[model samples]
Target: MCDGYATHNGELAIGRNLKVAFMPWKGYNFEDAIILSERVVREDLFTSLHIAEHVVSVRETKRGSEELTADIPNISENATKDLDENGMIRVGAHAKTGDILIGKITPKGESDPTPEEKLLRAILEKAGDVKDASLKQNHLTKVL
Candidate 1:
């Protein structure tokens, strides 16, 4: 049985079928890799990401046609609901390497500060006190 605890930067929704395993990280110890691909893909650590674990076929029901499973650790009976009472994504579904999923918790928009803008602002604001402007610029350039 899977421990159901997967160490991923991404969240695993309630009913999604994911191939969870301990995959190699930097060296000796393995990190819990909750991924879509059952097999290891080349250079998977950095490039090539998946958004969903499986293609959920829609049906007449608002909840869709995907079957919920109990294998996932903390999944509840109502895991297949399109959204919970609070309007968050239903818990059980998850994204994996090859699946075409939908809905992101963090929608893409101009809602937050851009990294470049923030970095540039930080440099300009702080560099005023520094003697060497070129050196600070160099450091920022490297960061960018």
Candidate 2:
């Protein structure tokens, strides 16, 4: 299981699945992370560009409500239907297979991978899509 923690800019931005691990983790002194992240990308800290991954939500919101409401602070509010009760919005889904990629971002980069990584990537490319989760994971492992 992932720890759901990633740091960014040395401060903490905690939230569900929003791993507070990269930089700017809650109240952390980013004084070091910023310098290092900058150097890493500029100096090729890992053989190539470092890629960080995260999920993006695809949510649904109604244009208007038929009959529902929530209190607004110092503002005029009218009837509104609760999104949770009607939202049911889902990210890209594969019909029949029920498989989905939800969201992903792969950095545009290339590296002189070790023979093993090269082999792994080739194998993964030949066998994938969201349907083969393992392959996708393995491919990412290689890239990272």
Q: On residues 28-89, what C-alpha lDDT tens digit does candidate 2 reach at each position?
A: 76643433445555776456455547344332222111221122222222211211232221
Model 1 segments beyond 4 Å from truth? 1-80, 92-144
Candidate 2: 10-residue stretch with minimal lDDT:
127-136
Residue-level error in angstroms, candidate 2, position 7 = 31
Model 1: per-residue Cα lDDT over 20-135, one tens digit each: 55666766565645455534455353343333233333233221122222222233334323333332334454423322122212112234445775477568852111111010
The 0-to-1 C-alpha lDDT of every candidate, in the order given, reads: 0.33, 0.31
Off by over 4 Å in 2: 1-37, 48-144
In candidate 1, position 114 carries an lDDT of: 59
Q: Model 1: how far is 107 from its true place, Å?
A: 24
